[model samples]
Target: MSLDYDLVIIGNSLEASYAAVKAAKLRARVALVLGETETNTYTEIDRSTFNCLTYLDKKGQNLTQWELNYDFVTHLNSSQIQTWITQVKQDIKEYYSPAILADLGIDIIGESGEFCRLPALGFVIKNRTLRSRNYLLAMGSISSIPKIEGLSELGYLTLETLDLENLPYDLIILSQTPIGIELAQSLNHLGKKVTLVVEDSNILPQEDAEAVQLIQAQLEAEGIKLLVNCPITQVRKIEDKKWIQAGNEALETDEIILITKPTPNIKGLNLEGVKVEVQPQQIIVNDKLQTTNPKIYACGSIIGGYSLSNLAKYEANIVIKNAIFYSIFQVNYHPLPFHIFTHPILSRVGLTETQARQSYGDDIIIIKQNYKTLAKAQILDETTGFCKIITRRNGIILGGHIIGNNSDELINFIALSIKNNIKIQQFSQLFPSYYTISEILFQISENWQYQKLQENKFLNNWLETLLFWRRRWKL
Candidate 1:
């Protein structure tokens, strides 16, 4: 069958860009339909830098009596941060422009695309109908706005509308999304009264309790109030204040933000008409990242989760491999860390403490490393969080969860250890670096081995006997 292109990508998101570049490099004819999807890749960085500013501000308050550079952090504001974000966004857009993709031999379609038929499939973009053997649905997701009373007429804000001036002085954030918590902290740091409404007991229910609790303490210390186990039932405008009936209280705030889950943007693709299986929230795909329609595939937010660029890039590669090479490769993300960019940052990989306990029961051993013990954290006045590592009784690592500055970087080493099945005793005890967070892992690894050896009666007796024998022989 003579097809128009080898593949037709249906969005201009990070996943779409990744597919376009890889397909182009593979010498396969590819068409990227930008369509009506407007993308903003700087959202993560924008969220992260605000926390960075907050950290800097805290540091300035603690150490400005002596350090000159630390005193300057007080002058930072939202306007300056926005300008930096705009400049970076411009640089990134130019680097990944449609013209650049075209130079790399990819057909860039400015118009929207719709599926024409199934089994023998093709995408119709305006006057052109590009036929392809396979399709990659990287269109991402639309914000799944909830059906709250007076929410539509009264109006509300979201993670998207952060640039507007005259934003609410007192903001009420609905949930604990990565963006929601980050926005809460940033807005609070920017002089707004931010209240995070968590329906559960913990702020970040997906993470380990210890880590989540530490981050919660940090948030509270920074003046961002957390309203846990408080679910909002109704939202309405009372004169000038936005009021919400949450739990037993009728809380009033200047603005209300619903951090609702995002649903896949598969409505226009007409998947049901073509018999492509889709669940309530996302398109149904197998471990190989293939949809019910073998000729089609989906990734990123279209699969229904947080819209993270790294996850998008990872899933896109999985799609490309299974779709192009005809290989069955299940998506393996065990080693990839799930990070939340809160004030001190939180990162986790593999099984959490609870999950490890459930899986290994009494065989699990938890080793905790405090940031207060690290010279780097003490030097930077970031001695507020800790790293909790879970492992088998005999020292095989099961998980790593950290909450602190540079924790995002420190968790990667433990993730690698878990991925490669490295034992705590097997890891070398030589950490020559001083005043660095990396030493925490080395210190904890040594402690795990020494404690296990010392606690075991048989091992300790055997070592003692060996030492006595060696002394007697004098060899």
Candidate 2:
């Protein structure tokens, strides 16, 4: 069987679905071949695990209702989030309507798509026979498995299957990530022995260090054994006893969980015939999300870019504008905000101190403020993290990183600041009052710019003299 359309989206994700919907709206005939049942499969997982009711903090104090509510409420008020919610809703209403998609000649082939070959033109997707087209591969990714001996025989769960219900087990060994950490914490709170092994220096390595530390402390307080810098080498189950080997040591556990990396789900699609290149584990795509062949494009996790759902959606928008409308839209990932859904949540945008230092130099200034100093954080009893801002010599906001309650929501303001190249003084002037964690940026700006100048003796002396003269003149 053969069908023709202006565009054929090869995955049913937030990215692919939105792209299909937008293209159809632009009066282009589109089709979507989906491997999954729905657009937001990961979102259907039990997010209640991240709720404060699941675990306790370092002080052995249970998370208050206010703290959870505050985080939830603040997330609703985020500027970046409002846009996402609106876009997603619009896309769903348009594409999900059978009449609209049918009217636009948009066909959704709900099947587990397989790649047949990589030809000189594009990949051939085979359900049974060879299906070729000007394809947009958005097949997404799967969790990476560690090369551990006997792991296959012992049985393990990836992030995709970790939330299976009513599975009784005495102990669970988790490789740390957002999903792994939340699972470990939730299981531990539910009265299970959970050991979390992190290959990185911290649990959420992508998050702010202070935030990682706070989350680590909280997990440890809840009796979650956190092993850092240790790579699991082997897993074997002998006579119902599971032995996990990690760095010259063996720990016995009932279950093992992998959260290391996510492999792109593009193996079955036979790409060799189409000659579309697949390097290592990712598909090559240009700024416009086009593959080597101009007619073919790719997006989402398959492109090996930022794996956040929101980022994928953003890329989808760009693809629709460029591919269908022929608009001069290019993908710009700068100031891309990310959030780690831990208890207090860790969020960041633009650059980190390490990244900024690499781009700039030692002359860069870092301003750090603790969440304890924030009135709302203290009142909510979740003041365990801090916010750090990286700026240049001229007080240009280089990046913003926050590890505290509502950090995910708070990072949006910083994302906007970095996007607009808003200066430190401008940020301070706009947000002068301390109403919430969002105002913490302004508070940091007030001290950060002047402190750098004060550290320079010559500049400090000149400023002091100028201040004295102004006082004498009463100006």
Candidate 3:
């Protein structure tokens, strides 16, 4: 039996569609198993709304405190925002539509399918069998709602089912992920009293503590109650009000939102039958991203962790190389950056301070710089965060954590540096535009140099001796 496609991507998520289009552009015979498309329409709207709120917040205009029913910054109400979101969603659907994809030389099959090991390995959808040389699973994950007493019957909202038009006055959010932190802030800005309950000791345990604290303080200042290390024991609906018993506290709210961990969408895929190792939350894959069955590969949310689009795309690129050709490419997430879209956004790359210290011991150096010290931050009145960089004694950047305005863009500079194995010394020689936020990197690098010099007593003495000789010579 001849192979029908070089690659058959399973799932209708944006990541799956993107992989299909990329494979097609590479001239590979690709087919997309289009199920109900998982559009990120609301996510984009929420981000846009947050940006508007951010502008007002920076302007020192407490719109929420003003009790403004309408967003003066965007000049739009909730109903108008929904209308715009619908149009945007329509546009996105058309862009990734089966017709458009088919025109791009991607065989878009609008049917759900499952892997079959018999009659040769292939995916079966209705009467048709898709036999591909290799298969890629980009099936995105779903919000893994926690198992709490009376929660299912009490009714709650997840990101997938959130309604922006009908937001509650008070809400309880159960999560510890970046999305959870972001939602808490965004909703708080929109005049909703948000109580964030986290099961972990700290939010973003993977990031630098100092950077995370800055964001945490900002959230508290904005009046969003944070209940760390609090696990929900039960949920109940007392008449029209919702009551949550988390840890030692019993909280009341108008609604409850769950942004818990994501469970991979592999239930109907028959992965076990196909000999693909499956975990409760993720699919097991090797460094090469090859599943237990080498003929099949998986990426995106199904692999677990953050489920970031950027990280998924990175894995997808590696999968493409291995599937399309005999390549030894393995996915490396060390240089990849992840960010939270809070007011003073948090972005980080590579190992955090604790991780670096654990691996490198006390030989690692920590460099810190404040956003307020930068002229750019002062001019913009957005100086509420700092940058923390961890490097080996040799100046090799082990990690970088930034919390401030434009940290998302700034962290990329460090990510690119780390990817190219560029040392922190290289940044010291850089002359970023004087009145730019990027100057913060240059300043941080200089601090690293000063710290190194301070650690070298002999060099410091030699510099002092040289200055004394120059003074005595009186040239």
lDDT of each: 0.78, 0.68, 0.83
Clashes of each: 0, 21, 0
Residue pairs in clash, model 3: none
Q: What are the per-residue Cα lDDT tens digits for candidate 3 across 160-180? A: 888878987899999957788
2 or 3: which has the higher lDDT? 3
TM-score of each: 0.92, 0.80, 0.92
Where is the poorest 10-residue window by lDDT in model 2? 72-81
lDDT score, candidate 3, position 268? 73
Question: Which of candidates 1 and 2 reaches a greater TM-score?
Answer: 1
Q: What residue pairs are clashing in model 1?
A: none
State the lDDT of candidate 1 residue by residue for 323-437, as single tens digits: 7778587898777776788878888888888888888889988888898999999887778888888889978888888988798887777777888888876655666489888
Best of the candidates, lDDT: 3
Stretches off by above 4 angstroms in model 1 are 37-42, 61-71, 465-475
Count residue pairs with overlapping backbones in model 2. 21
